[model samples]
Target: MDTLPDPVGSSQMDIETSQAGGTPEVANSAAKPRVRAPVRVEEAPKFDLDTYIANYTGRTRYDRLYLIGTCSPSLANEALKAAIAEAKASKDIIKYEKAVRALSEVAPSDPEATLNSAWVQETQRSVNAQTERLEGELKGYKNNLIKESIRMGTEDLGNHYYRTGDLAAASKAYSRVRDFCTTPNHITSMLFKMVSVSIERGDWLSVQSNVHRLRNSQSKPEDAARNEPKIAAAWALAQMQQGAFLEAANSFLAIPADLGDSYNEVLTPNDVAVYGGLCALASMNREELQRNVLDNQSFRNFLELEPHIRRAIAFFCNFKFRPCLDILESYRPDYLLDVHLQRFLPQLYKRIRTKSIEQYMIPYNRVTLDAMAKIFAPSVIGGEAKPTDISSPFVQELIGLIQDGVLDARIDMEKGLLISNQVDLRSEVQRSTLENFREFNQEAHWRILRAQVLYHGLEIKSDKKFGDGGKGARFSREGAGFD
Candidate 1:
């Protein structure tokens, strides 16, 4: 194998030539470099929202903590404990203070109990120290810086106090920031917070004023969208408190569900059902209930939450008197607990019952006293026949409905029957048309007579007052009057 190689394929010659710093002959074809495959990144382990939110701290944690605490007390307590521990371990005074106040909201107890807790006591000490340091820093600043500091400090204090459920203190603090807001959005946000606190305190006048500010503020599109739901809900709440049911119902119905769900902390879907249903029942007519309430798809969704309310409305729409009243009567205890509804429950019930009675009588030419009693009388298990006399309360109620024009029918006391007062439209129209024709004929006859007399060169004379002097006037067919 040690024979001499070909000159063109001389491997030894090439090796020797490369060693002697001479270029070697190379093949024209070359292999391509291999491409390494891209590394695959595994998807981040599924995020746990509960665990993620537990890390939230600062003043923003108050509302989130409330929601979590209500839904899962143990998780909220764990999160609170972790925050408190971290705050103390790191010596973060603000975190420790907010965490303690948030604890008070989650599990409210006696003042002494909260004050006696070691963590709360430590938070209080930190708060005092911070306040002293802040005051010391305030004294060294110029007037402008001092005013700016005070303004920022007041707003921060207001937010802190609001989170701690001290509405009065929060309101005072917020009031001091009014003169310092530089932008329209800042002013609007401040007023909105003020309105919220005023609602909590039931100060309707203040709420009205602040809500007015929010409405009149020049807000950008995003800001307006963010604030509209709150404005509508607050206005509706005020209207509800004032017993303006129709206004409240309309307002509540106008809110989008996505936005309205945010107010579940204040008003539940069940409350919406009660408020909207009762208001509509009290104010709307049978046709209106059928058109605006029962048939309205959006409102129907809310009514679906309370089946009995939906059923009651359905019964009323179908003119079923006993069942509608029965449904309302059965749920009377539930409605009584609602502070706003309780005040007007009796009146609303009376109105609904009266409307049902009116509807029941609509198709009848004359209904017997027994039939009226059978419908309006309280429920009986065995369906016993109750002989209702002409003097029964139901009869008097019908008479009242008649008087109120809620029912176009009258009670015949002697005959023991309800007589419908509904007029036949065809007959009424024919009679009216005939009367109009007769009047037109009489006027034409008089005009023809006057025209014939005028054609013969005669003028019509009347002794009626033409002016203040009560002078008589003569008239020709063309209505030319000469006094």
Candidate 2:
């Protein structure tokens, strides 16, 4: 530019010269490239695993231990193998301890397994300590349940013994309950059972003592009342048996009105009639008997409606033959009269048929004869009355007429009519009429039939040969079976 020297030719010469030697631009470019602050690639601080592991010692110690072990499994396994080899090589305790310590230093890989192992050890220690406490509590609950069950069983056993009339057994059972009972109600119930057992055993002093205890004890009124009647009835019966009639009557009269009503309502007709009759007999008051009879609707209803029952009662109470015979004739019951009816009939017949009795007399069936012997034989005859005592004087008189062939003659002479025309004689037209009587008096028949009706009456039995032979003959032991 200074001389602008030959412009283009000068520039060409400079370029040629620069190319011959290293050009200034090439030399400058080669001068270390101006060292532009070496572009720093900052490689994220080389991922310092040691520092990470160290930081986690307290916070994630288990995690750090797992990571170290997993990352170097081969190294850790090799270390364990070497330790095991050393332990196997030498049995020295010191060597073993060293191997165990070294192996323990290699942390467990599973953090959860390590934590679980520690937790299990701690839980085992606590469980061992608490087991005794829990066992004691469990034993207490078991004992309570066992005691309750025993109480229930004892109560039931006492009740069973009482029903079966095993007073001693019942008392023992009740005593067991009382001994173990923890509750007042249980004690009271046991006391009541004791009292009832005493009454059934007829231990009057014990009954009185128990009753007094029951009165003093706090109990339900209904329960107390339920136990009182039987005791009172038993006491009254005992007094009556001892010939203390007035005292016994007073005792029976003292029975609560409600109790009497309950008895009347609950007892069967026969039971009510029998007990009412006993009460009347004890008091020796016809009015009381009538009142009891009327009060018991069953007895009154039967007497009013059942002619046979009425006939039985009439014969039993009045010993009147005409009324009873009239009632029996009117009813015409298929079955024969029971012993209570048969016993009075003889006396009734003698009193009513003294005049022209042969005409009015009816031949006695075997059933009638058996019943008569059972009912009245003891009282009238010196020997014990038996169901088979058909040989009484009154019965012999009737049987003699038939045996002597004078029944028809006597009937005709007394009534001035043919024997066929007489109502009383018409019933015995055939000897086979006695067959029903024989069957009715048979032991087997009475055992089955009377057992069905009375449930507990008539212990007689027809002889085995008679029953087996189909003869239908019956017989009974002598004396009153009650004694």
Report the number of the highest-lDDT candidate: 1
In candidate 1, what are the lDDT values of residues 299-390, reduced to their tens digit?
Answer: 77778778888888888888887888888887774454332454477878887877677667666777887677778875431354434554
lDDT of 2 by residue, 331-364 (tens): 3211112111122333333432332233233342
Q: Return the TM-score for candidate 2, rounded to 2 decimals.
A: 0.28
Per-prediction TM-score, please?
A: 0.57, 0.28
**Global lDDT of each model?**
0.60, 0.40
Worst 10 residues of 1 by lDDT: 24-33
RMSD of 1: 27.3
